[model samples]
Target: MILRAFLFLIVVWTLPAMGPWQDCEGAKACDLDGRSYHIRVPDDWDGDTALPVLLHFHGWGRQGDLIVKHQRISGHTRRRGVLLIAPNGRGRTWDFWDQGSADVPFAAAVIEDVAKRFPIDRDQIFVSGYSYGAAMAWRFACENGDGVTGLLAVSGTLRQTERCPQAPKHIRHVHGFADTVMDFPMGAGGDVTHPVALWRKALGCAAGRRLPEWQVVSFLSFERWHWDNCEGGHTVTLDLHSGGHFIPHGWIGWQLDQLMGRVPLYP
Candidate 1:
């Protein structure tokens, strides 16, 4: 069931505070740099506890609203009690590759604004994206590692640049070996090796160790390469899947399980 990809934007302000949590269910407006980003919060939140937040970016020409509808993200956010912030790109595309893109500053502001309005765990902030959005995710995680707890990039890789962030962080990149749109090994869609090498070098890892087990979910199977014993709890992982350009079913849960240290279900 391939869902149509559409991207959106929203801007929001603080809402009326309830007993313990603010009622932030459904779509709301979030203002950053005079632009509005549409954000979704779960209604079932207890309001008293600080929850992790995920900033999800859509692929090029896709809207934030469409990502929630198509990416199976809303269900994940609801069940995980995660605050989701999906911001639209200026022209349905993010300028993250450009060193001077305003999207970076806007993203930083959005995080701050969300924290001010909700009970968000600052230390557990996450960023994720697909395709072009995936590139943006890498850019953000690379440049602002200190502010991000982890990042997940699908079907894309980081843009070549002068330098990478010195801060240690966790990173996961998932790519389909059969992808044709982004072209798995070449083309604009980044291959797994370069990004992994980039981070390994930055983290001073002489080599990456291979995981003992391969993970599988339905028709999707992946093997992992991990950089170990890096400074500052920094971990770099690359999961190469035997699939295509589209996001596979259960992909979100699979990555989340990895993040939470839960084993992926194998068949």
Candidate 2:
């Protein structure tokens, strides 16, 4: 199955080859500021299925391809039934919130545009990212989680929770304990807020125990933490033990599949 999927991506990449989506047989694009996002077309895409959608944001110096490449490519219209979108940043690094209101608007534009063009299910819309990209996800979640089911925030810190909106929504955070760039103990002090603690407080799960459930990828120890009893809803943390800023292979696919529930596995 892995070989087939790998070959499938290989075939996709071989076509019209530009960025990773050069051969994305089911992709579309929008060029702005010289940046292009190669969107994938689900094998089962009917243009009216009201399926779910995922907005994938990349970290600093990264783009949509980084997220798409890691996604479980499906010839079907959706993955696990959800339509996934990997939006490239005009600046190669997204500013979903921060001071770059322009980027945020651009992101919002992409979300709306895709939903309009595809049969995206409104209730299951989701956003996810890594490192700086995670920071951007938090920004969006803080501002838009009301519309989204939840956020798959990974390997980065949040901005000052104090400056964030008054009420937060369902949030799933995945952080690495040994991340030197964004350490667990530094809570925004390391340029990114210590996400887990703040999220726990916000979710009203500030007292949950730290459960270690994870895996090792490329010799790096990684794990996830959980904090139940959230205020608005439920929340989980994919805490990486010795993980770094990069997203591991297995978890990425799992996340995409898990959230895109009912979406057929990428064929």
Candidate 3:
């Protein structure tokens, strides 16, 4: 009886600690070390397959719950069989200007926690955000690029220029020509293109040449620049639209398709 009791204690001690978001469905709140976030799995997920994930950040004054419920973002992720993780910034805003900010570590912690609860495809983990959240995503990519596949930034970029320890495997940034909130070409920082240029330089892409494409749907049009030649055979794309500050319709889906190697259906 004593031996059996000792075995049980060993088993209990060896078991992994329960995560705050374990067994959660739809959009549910998750807390880690006083920080909060939210998560959603695809409705058709088999629970055994290792699925890719998208860590999407919300705009200023917005929370993770909003991102989880966003039909465009969440719907595209669900249809692509990708898990969605949205982390709430402290006070509904990200402190991403500094490379040593707390949000960077908090973001990493959230990813680690989620991986503990589910089978995640570490190689396919993507990061994205809108407006201020996009700025956060940029910073996260700069600091944690080694751990992620790529970044999809919309309507925003890094708040300031800082040396990136690692660059993401790929990057796709979409912005508007007429954006006034964050400004076009120049965002919170002097040059919105700084991150892309930095990545291009870091990855050693060929100098002064990029392929351009145009895609139009109904009344919306986009001008895209593609850099296919870079170190490690990675790609960097920048999509400029004619509209004001906002994510283009079906943009995320199209980008995801391209990343997943599926035929991109323009939307």
Highest-TM-score candidate: 3
Q: For model 2, what is the error of residue 71's alpha carbon versus the real structure, in angstroms, after optimal superposition?
A: 4.8
lDDT scores of the candidates, listed in order: 0.69, 0.59, 0.81
lDDT of residue 179 for candidate 2:
72
Of candidates 3 and 2, the better by lDDT: 3
Off by over 4 Å in 2: 1-28, 31-36, 71-79, 96-100, 166-169, 183-193, 216-222, 236-238, 256-267
Cα TM-score per model? 0.81, 0.71, 0.85
In candidate 3, how many Å is residue 159 off? Answer: 5.1
* Model 2: per-residue Cα lDDT at residue 20: 31
Q: Which ten contiguous residues of candidate 2 have the minimum total lDDT? A: 16-25
**Per-candidate clash tally:** 18, 25, 0
Q: State the lDDT of candidate 1 residue by residue for 1-267, as single tens digits.
A: 123222211111122235322343345445566675656665476656887888888899987877655546656665666778888788888987755567877887878877777778887788888899888877777666677877878887665443675433687777878888766644345545654666767777657776864654546567788876777678888787778887656666566666766764321
Candidate 3 lDDT tens digits, 1-267: 999999999877645433334655456688788888888887667667888999999999999998887877887888888889999998999998777888998999999989887889998999999999998998899888887887999988764346788778888999887899877755445643453676777677775343465563577777666788888877788887778988777888788888988987643
Error of 3 at 183 (Å): 1.1
| Model 2 C-alpha lDDT per residue in residues 142-232, reported as the tens digit of each score | 6556677767777765654434453334567766656776555554446222456656665566555556654524564454556656766
lDDT-superior candidate, 1 or 2 = 1
**Local error of candidate 3 at 173, Å?**
0.3
